[model samples]
Target: MSEPLVSIRSANLFTPNGTRIWKDLNWDLFPSEIHALIGESGSGKTTLAYSLFGLLGESWKYDFLHWDVLGYDLSYWSGPFGEELRGRSIFLVPQNPNLAFHPYRKIKDQVIDFFRLGLRSSEDPKEILELWKEMGITRPEEKWNSYANGLSGGEKQRICLSLALLGDYRILVLDEPTTGLDANTEKWVLRAIRKKSEEGKLGVIFISHDLRIVESMASRITIMKEGSAIESFPVKDRKIEPTTEYGKELEKARRFFL
Candidate 1:
């Protein structure tokens, strides 16, 4: 196996009020692989997503016995290097797509600004347009001029995915990225994601509660419960259900597994 894109062992995260939100977390993700983190709400899945790029704010404290992401040791993550790695090396697509863009700015302008930041390796507008079309945006040229408020939820999600693909990021963290999409749109989006991950050698951290989608997309999965990882396993060719009691419960709830 190639080197992991992210590796964390004995990690913990605490809120500003000193309440522990994550406990003893151990996780790993490798290049060109889709690793799914699945659990119910408040399981700290999204918190883990934000924690990858150290976006949990100063008040929140995070500690890891071994912390590394995209070849950088993040055990003592802070300062200029931390600031530089967030959007450039590790790109996160928030659960709420609205958080990704300026509400008042046109999408075209924001794309240009992101390009100018030198986060992405390529500056080709045509490539961006190609991704838009692949994401099922008809007449992406016209959509480019519209504001964030103008696009539908699915469009916003796809736009964020496209930006992540175009950027130079090695790891893409997606938090409930397919939430608002219809079945057909979801299919297209997933196809595009698979294409990009394989072609670009991107490692994807897919956090979603929907087991059906998780089963379809993920090569491996980690089950989280109350801020802890209970089990992690390969899903591609396994005929039996997960071994852990919690994982069995999850499988029962989902009614099926790959």
Candidate 2:
């Protein structure tokens, strides 16, 4: 069998104040799979996405954060190793793109910086310009040179996603890519993500509260609650049954929460 693209094992997380949250938490992302990580607000779904890149918040701790990606060990990577890992191995698109870029810098410069950090090949300005057009940003040249303040929320999100795709990463983690997008943009973004996953280039771990979207996109489903993975199953299975009450409710009322 092929190895999983990434794995997290023996993780026991706790709040920074010394409150235990989960014990022996584990999960895997197989190649080319779209794994949906779903839960209500404050269930730690975004934290789990952050943990994959060792971006532990001030209020979090872990007994062990053992992780591996594409045959490279990142369990204890720090300093330069941590920088390289984040810049190349795994990519994360935050729900809020406002914090990702410097307000004072041009978007073009920021994207070039990302190219330098995450890529090893020679940079071609046209490549990013192409990405700009592909990401649905009209007038690529103008948008490319504009700073964050000049872009709309959906535009910023698309630009951020475009940046994420430029990296030669094995896994991509998305935290609610459709947060503020209009229906058309949302559909386009999701279609782009699904197309990428289907191309078998990398695995994607998508964190979202939208079960309807998850139902259509995910090859496997994982429901998390209170910092633990309460349930998980292959989406292709003939029957999916969750043992937790929360899961049952979520399954039954996919639209109510959204």
Cα RMSD (angstroms) for every candidate in the order listed: 2.5, 2.6
Tell me how many clashing residue pairs each candidate has: 0, 0
Every candidate's lDDT = 0.82, 0.77
Highest-scoring model, lDDT: 1
Q: Global lDDT for candidate 2?
A: 0.77
User: What digit string (tens of lDDT, one per residue) describes model 1 on residues 1-258?
Assistant: 899988989999999999998888999999999888987788988888777766777888877798887767754345567876675677777899988889999998998877677666558888888878877888899889999999888788888878876787688888888877778878877877888889888899998877888888888898889999988988865332578988888877875431
In model 2, which runs have C-alpha deviations exceeding 4 angstroms? 57-59, 65-67, 70-75, 237-243
Clashing pairs in 2: none
Q: Please list the residue runs of candidate 1 whose C-alpha ends up more than 4 Å from where it truly belongs after superposition.
A: 238-240, 255-258
Write model 2 residue lDDT over 75-184, tens digit each, in one string: 44433567676777677888998978899999889888887776435567798788777667789899888989998887888888876666677788888877777677
TM-scores for all predictions? 0.90, 0.88
